[model samples]
Target: MEYVPVWIAIGLVIGVVGKLAMPGRDPGGFIVTILLGIAGALLAGFACRAADIGGDGGLAIHGAAAVGAAVLLILYRLVMWSRTR
Candidate 1:
């Protein structure tokens, strides 16, 4: 709802950072990275809501989103790599 915009912005930043974090061929290119980042943010935001980890928006949420995005990028890389094998 209200958080959608924030998530998109965060995703854009995290996706760019994730690209640098994961240096290699992206099977789906930048678009995929951006999508993964958005998914990561959504996942983190939901998890935070469920866990009540951090009340409302804050830096903690952004940090969590970054970690989530990184993990997703790694997973995406592994999956794409394994498919080639």
Candidate 2:
């Protein structure tokens, strides 16, 4: 409830970082970026919660989130490439 904004901020940061970290140009626009970030954050939060990596801090931006975002970006690229080829 109260953590919605936090999650959005975290997502935005993670998404931007993920996009920047990835090599070469990626597709999509602002909405896609936002969605990617939100999804990445959610994935990381869930994984961390399941693995108990960050204690009980709920969903926040951290190493796991960054990694998750990167992973998502990589997967996105792979899928896009596969579709093109």
Candidate 3:
């Protein structure tokens, strides 16, 4: 079996961890959470590469990306809440 890329693995971890970090009523289910985490990882990768803040083997980049993803998800939930009210 082929191993998943480090970046992908990192992204998945970030996504799962990030979601867990955020508390509250999140719309959707487990799949949604997984998607959010993976999406966050991807976003983090792109952001880091674009800003040239990657490749240092530091947790900062990964953490930042997770935070970013969580922030986006929270915003999404808030918007949804507003629209429903």
Task: Give the top-scoring candidate (TM-score).
Answer: 1
Given candidate 2, what's the lDDT at residue 69?
62
Candidates by lDDT, descending order: 1, 2, 3
Candidate 1 lDDT tens digits, 45-74: 668767887678677776776677677877
| Per-model tally of clashing residue pairs | 0, 0, 1
lDDT of 3: 0.62
Q: Candidate 3 residues 1-85, lDDT tens each? A: 1212444566567556656776556566556766766676667666776687746646667666667666656666677679777
| Candidate 2, residue 56: lDDT | 59
Worst window of 10 by summed lDDT in candidate 3 = 1-10
The candidate scoring highest on lDDT is 1
Residue-pair clash count for candidate 3: 1
- The TM-score measured for candidate 1 stands at 0.79
Each candidate's root-mean-square deviation in Å?
1.9, 3.3, 4.1
